[model samples]
Target: MSLTAGILAGAAGTTALNIAGYLDMTVRGRPASVLPARAAGELAERAGADLGSGETADSRREGLGALLGYATGLAVGGLYGLLAGDRRLPPPVAALGLSAMAMAASVTPLTALRLTDPRDWSASSWVSDIVPHLAYGLTAATVYDRLTRL
Candidate 1:
């Protein structure tokens, strides 16, 4: 698939996943409050420090990682869709894709620090993160399918 098409598809998929996550939380009667945008902005600023020292090179690496990550997600999700009779397995594909992304992140060597702290993440945080990744995977797959017969 074309790069632009893939990105557009991925964005749509991410949005859908976000909506699904909010709905899931609501259905479970959990607090559906989003982290304050200001707080998120502040956290991003703090996270920026972790990205120390390789600004230009890191940007290129990140771009590559994102592209590779999307492709990996698409393959996994597409395979899941094909193999599993139930449609729900695509979520599992997404999970696998996300795990692969972590591996990709580890090997990419773009930044000085690993972006996410697994130890610091609660189960809820993990689920939240994975669900969106899965959405991205599925989106990538859908886009790829539309763009390429493969």
Candidate 2:
């Protein structure tokens, strides 16, 4: 798979995932997850940059969290693009795989840094994480397949 196609497909897929995630949040009356923002804060601290205190940090944290999410999608999409033509897994299954890969990308680092734990998540929390990823995977896989013609 071409890097260009992967990037394009990943962006499209990530957009779809965000739409799904926001919709779920609206429907459930849930606040956005803070784990990513906190993770971003940790990364910033490690880089010797203060996110500042109070509102500024909150705002930047939120924005940076989203950018990181987008970057995750791009990375996964690039991987998917590289694997696009493999016939061992059909598009539907490949979508599931892609979604899990993205989820792992988010979950692993957060957990490793002691910022979050999936083990502590509730069922709804699980749903919150899974749905958007499913949306991402399905959307990305379909787009990747279609665009790359694999």
Candidate 3:
């Protein structure tokens, strides 16, 4: 596939994955609302600390940054699939790669803020967070494959 084809396919895949995640989070009664003001404020402060002197928090910038991240992930994943030379890289490996990519995307919000460390996660954390990532990966691959095959 060409770059454009890869990107379009990836955008569709990621959007589907995100929709599924949003629905699952809703069903599980997870926090759908944005973080509270106080938490957001703290996070902004923490994120600002690494900036050079005179740096300050910009909520709009942070939000834009998050948007860029999603864009980047879609681009990266699509290119990766393209470079794999066959969108048909065996199901198991594709599933695992997709799972890893999804998890990488999932952890971005916190990781971007240096808020949470995956290595510090507990068994339950792995089960709850990681398992969902795996499911999303499998689902995303299935969706992409189905679409491209048509």
Candidate 4:
């Protein structure tokens, strides 16, 4: 039950994150990031899996990247459920913790692949990165709390 609730919460949170990102793009007129696809391609190459050439490869990478993001969100949510069980943390703590965990999970791989370095990000870049995660955290925490309240 907890796991199910967490996963549903995660789905909601992921949706919120995506909406926030799209809104940011609309407001700022910035292009979408290709880092996710690049990360997927790099990992696939490292694992000795060929994704093919030309447009097909690009499409595959994009699809894989999206799937990877979903997987990360769901896995994180499942972990949260397992950890929290029937207990509820304070709202702020849950939000911060979940946001930090998701951010770390997403960023660590890119950093490891030398794809990005958050330490050198500009203020605006940091803001762009963080705001969406905060949305995810807040939504996920709220949903989880509501669903688990008995």
Q: lDDT at 141 for candidate 3?
A: 64
Better of 3 and 4 by lDDT: 4
Q: Write down the RMSD of all candidates, one decimal each.
A: 9.7, 1.7, 5.7, 0.9
State residue 96's C-alpha deviation in candidate 1, in Å: 4.2
Off by over 4 Å in 3: 33-62, 105-113, 122-124, 143-150
lDDT of 4 by residue, 61-84 (tens): 999999988888887788888898
Q: Looking at candidate 3, what is the lDDT of residue 38?
A: 28
lDDT (C-alpha) at residue 114 in model 1: 47
Ordering by TM-score: 4, 2, 3, 1
Best by lDDT: 4
What are the per-residue Cα lDDT tens digits for candidate 3 across 1-150? 445445655565566556755766777766632322223545556677432222244454445445654675576457655675445767778667877876776576556666677888787556566665566566556655655565
Residue 144 local lDDT, model 3: 56
Report the number of clashing residue pairs per model. 0, 0, 0, 0
* lDDT by residue (tens digit), candidate 2, 1-150: 467777887898899999998998899888888888988988888999888899999999988988999999999988877776444458778799989988898899999989877999999889989999999998888887777664
How do the residues 9-96 of candidate 1 rate in per-residue lDDT, one tens digit apiece?
4455545555766777877777643232223333445666343336654554455444544454444434434443233334455445
Candidate 1: deviation at residue 16, Å? 2.4
Superposition error at 30 for model 1 (Å): 2.7
**TM-score for each of the candidates:** 0.46, 0.92, 0.60, 0.96
The lDDT per prediction is: 0.48, 0.86, 0.58, 0.90
